[model samples]
Target: MSIAASSDAARATRRPVNANGVPIHTTSFIGTNWTNRTAESPPPPEPGSYYPMAFLVEQPPGSVVQSHFHAADQFQVVVAGGGHLGRHAVRPVTVHYTNAHTAYGPITAGEAGLHYFTLRNGYDPGARYVPQEAAALKAVPGRTPWQTTTAPVEPGPVIEGPARMEEMLEPRADGLGAWRHILPPHAALTGPDPAQGMGQFWVVTGGRLDGMPPLSLIFVNPQDAARTAMAGAEGAECLILQYPRRAADA
Candidate 1:
C-alpha cells in the first residue's frame, strides 16, 4: 500500500506540444514518478512488471483533450470544475472507467476549467490519439470497449455517525467496483478487501484521512490486507476505485 498527500506531489508541464497545431494545455501533479515526464530525458518504460501511476491533470477553461486510448485500464475521477468528457457532462466527484485500449473522449473544459486524477495499476507508454492512430488501434487485439460514468455528487461536511458507505458503481462479476465512504471525525473504518480485485485506490474527496487533506491518495495492492481509513477531526469522505480481475486471475 502507498499513501500520498496531493500537496506534496511533484508538479510539471510537458514541453509545449502542438503536433496537431492545437496547443496541448495541461499541468500535471504527479504522485508517483514511475516514469518521470518532467525529467530532461524521461526514462523508457520498464518491461515485464507493474508500476502504478497516479497523477492529476489541470486544464485551463476551453482547453480540449483529443479522443484517445491508453494501453492500460484506468479510472479517472473529476475532482473539480466542470467539463464534457466526450458527450457526457462531467463535474466534481464523477467517476469514469475505461478498459485498456478502449478509446474515449475529446474532453472539453468548461468555463471554470477542469481538474481530474488519473489512476492506473500498470504502466502505459502514453495516449494514442484517434484518427491519426486509428490504424494502430485496429492493429491491436480488441478488448471490450467497456466504459461507464457514475453520477456526480457534491461532497458535504462529515456528519456524526458510524461511517456511511455507498456503492457508486455496482460491483460486477469481474470485480470492478467503486464506492464512496463518509467517516465521522476520528472514526476508523476498514475498507473492502483488496484481494477481491486487481487493486484499489482510496481518494480523499472531502475532509481528511489520517491527517491527510482532500486529494490525498492511497493505492492498495491485491495482496495487501484490508486497510482501515481513520478520519481526521474534520472527518473524511473518500472514494474507493477498484480495477477488474486481471486476465491471469480470470
Candidate 2:
C-alpha cells in the first residue's frame, strides 16, 4: 500500500513498546527475538515515516542463522553487539543492503549478542532456507561478485547537526538503498525524491524523528499524504531507506 504524501502530517512516535508503554511482543527468529513494527500492513495511520514494515531482531550469543534469501529486498543494520554477517564482522551501526533473492548469513553473534534493525520496502516474502545453495554460491557472504553492489556494508561517518543528508546509495527505482539524517533540536528533513516505482522510509536510531515528536518507525509510501517533513524532537539522528529501482521489474 502506498503511503500518501502529506503537506501536513503529524509525527507520532510508537516505541518498540506496547499500549502500556512497555515493549511489544516479538516473534522468534531462529533462537532470537524479532520485534516488528510494520510486519503487517499500515495502521496507527497517524505518523508514518518511511517504509511499510520493519523489525528489530536480537540474536543470542553463539546464535547461528542458516543461509537464506527472501522473495523481497531487505535493509538490515547492526545496532549493537557484534557478529559475523557471513564472514564479515558486523559491529554497532553497520548498514547492510541485500537485493531480492540474494543469499546471506550463518550469522554467529558475539558474546554480548547481536542486535540489528531489519527493514523491508515491499511485502514480507518470508524466508527461504537454502543453507546448501547459499554455501555453494558464496565465495564471500556479502561481497559475492554477482549478488553485491559497491554500496558500503558499513555505515558512513556520522553527520551531526545542521540537518544533512548523505546519499549512501545512488538514486534508483525499486528495492532498497541507505541514507542517514543527523539533526539537532527542532530540525527537519525531506527525503530525496525517489525514482519512479521507488519509495523511502525513515527510522529514528538515536533520539526522536517525528511528524509530531519522538516518531519511531514511520512509513512513507510512494505518495503518502499523511506527512512530508520529518522533524527532530531533540538531538535526533535517523537512518533513511530507499528501495533502488530495478530492471525487468525484478
Candidate 3:
C-alpha cells in the first residue's frame, strides 16, 4: 500500500471525531464548586478502547477540592493560577496524572485560585470523594475505589526541550503517560515521529491551535500522524496523551 493510503487506513481504525470543540460552560459535580469547558466527548464508535475526552476545570479563590477519586484515569494540566496537590505546591502548567481510584486532593486554591484542563481516558463513572462512606461519592463500590495499580497521584511540569518537545511522564500499568509539544507560531508537526506510533490526543494548553481552540484536543492514530495540522500566530503548547489505543480485549 502507498504510504498515504496506509496512513489513511490506519486513521480509519480509530473512533469518529465530530470536529468543532464543544464548550463546557459550568458544572458543580464532585464535592467542590468549579466550572469547566469540554473539548471532546466519548468516542461514538468504540466499546472498550481508550475513549479519551478533554475539558477545563476551575476552582475559585479560597475554595478547596476535597480529597477524591474517579472511576477512570485522568490528566490535569494546571493551566492557570496556583494551588496545592494535597501538600505539594503546584503552579500554572504543572501536570498531574492520576490513576483510577487513586485518592488525591484536598486541593486548596492559591491566592489566584486554580484552573486546569482535565483529559480523561477510559470509562468515566464520575468523581467520588475519599472514604467509601461519603454520600457525595458517585462511583459504585466495584468501581468506586477501583483496583489501583499506580501511585495515588503525580504532579509536575513538562521538561523544557530545545526542540520544544518532551515526554513529560511515562505511564505505569495503571498510570497514563503524557508528552508536551511546543510549536512556534505558524509552525506545525513535521510528521508524527515513528517513536510516537501508538496513539495520542493533543490537548491545546497554551496559545491557540488554529483549527481548534484553547482547552481543545484531537486524537490521531500513529500510522496517520501526518493527518494533523497546527497553525497559529502566537505559537502553541499541548499536552499529548501517550496511552495505548487498543481495545480492552486486544
**Best candidate according to TM-score:** 1
Over the stretch 121-179, how does candidate 2's per-residue lDDT look in tens digits? 65543455676556644543343222332333343333443666666665544445576
Name model 2 segments beyond 4 Å from true: 1-51, 132-161, 172-176, 195-197, 211-215, 225-227, 248-250
Q: List the residue pairs that clash in candidate 3.
A: 24-37, 24-38
Model 3 per-residue lDDT at 68: 76
For model 1, the local distance difference test gives 0.78
The per-prediction tally of clashing pairs is: 0, 32, 2
C-alpha lDDT (0 to 100) for residue 84 of candidate 3: 81
TM-score of each candidate? 0.88, 0.65, 0.61
lDDT of 1 by residue, 1-250 (tens): 5555454454443323442334544334433343345566456465213556777766778888889988878999999899999899999999999988889998889999888888887777677789889888778764667899888988877699678889999998788999999988898978888889888888889888877778878888888899886888988999999888867765
For model 1, the stretches where C-alpha displacement exceeds 4 angstroms are 9-35, 38-49
- In the predicted model 1, the residue pairs found to clash are none
Arranged by lDDT, best first:
1, 2, 3
Task: Compute the lDDT of residue 111 as modeled in candidate 1.
Answer: 96
Q: In model 3, how large is the Cα lDDT of residue 187?
A: 72
Better of 1 and 2 by lDDT: 1
